[model samples]
Target: MDPFKNWQDWRKNLDAFFGENFLSSFENILLYNYFPQVNVYKTDNELIVLANIPGLNDINNVDVFIDYQSLELRGNVNLKYKGFKLIQDELFNGHFERKINLPYPVKEDRIDATYQNGLLIIHLHRLIPDDHRRHKIEIKKIEE
Candidate 1:
């Protein structure tokens, strides 16, 4: 009885028990954390975000939120093909939420988001702090 032969037999048994898609399933599980993949771009005065989220019946189903330092997204991808057996399921179909940190602080009031062609585009302007808000304090020396 060779050790190499025993190892091969064990591998065969595992494959037979888990089926061919076991590897794919494992990959999906590992990659599930970053669903609806997004690309972020930063300019001198603006920050742009592009997200890929398809299979949405209504664009309103997605919610977008932003703050000075981050952007939050919550949505669902539903492909309405019910009453049929699914084979080779690969497309993402479920609820997903992702919070992305912005490169710079963005102005909350000046933000825009649009959805078109299965893509969500977000445009934001960088926040410039007001210089006039700073005030000088006077120091007094104590006399003994």
Candidate 2:
């Protein structure tokens, strides 16, 4: 029998076995990079993205980019400790990048972003079309 069916199940089992804080250490040892957590919400006329990235004190440390249908996030978080004996550390550091696909077309020029209290919030205005219904496609027989 397979111990885990998917990545989420494996991560959950690992978290149960080693605890949440210790999983970070394990992930750091096994993985090359880390990514911040993000949540995306969509409405009829807008899309909102919230990224949880701790230790981002400088605005220059993070970058956000978006087009009509996609979003890209790139940044670096520094966790360098000088002259101190390190114990347990759960926070993720170093460079990270994440890309997200938006559900609807948006106006790229009307996008706005703000970072506060370790959370990066982005608002994108959706482009309204004359028709919002899905168009049916007619399948033609391909001559092979």
Residue pairs in candidate 2 whose N, alpha carbon or C atoms collide under 3 angstroms: none
lDDT of 2 by residue, 1-144 (tens): 112225477788878887775566565655434266677888889889998888887879899987678888999998777998668766787888987778888887898999999999999998876686888999999999
Write one digit per residue (lDDT tens) for candidate 1, span 12-93. Answer: 6667898754555455655566777788888899988999988877987899998778899998888758798888777788
User: How much lDDT does each candidate structure score?
Assistant: 0.81, 0.79
| Number of the top-ranking candidate, with lDDT as the measure | 1
TM-score of 2: 0.67
Using TM-score as the measure, the top candidate is: 1
Error (Å) of candidate 2 at residue 107 is 1.0
Can you tell me which runs of candidate 1 are displaced by over 4 Å?
Answer: 1-26, 135-144
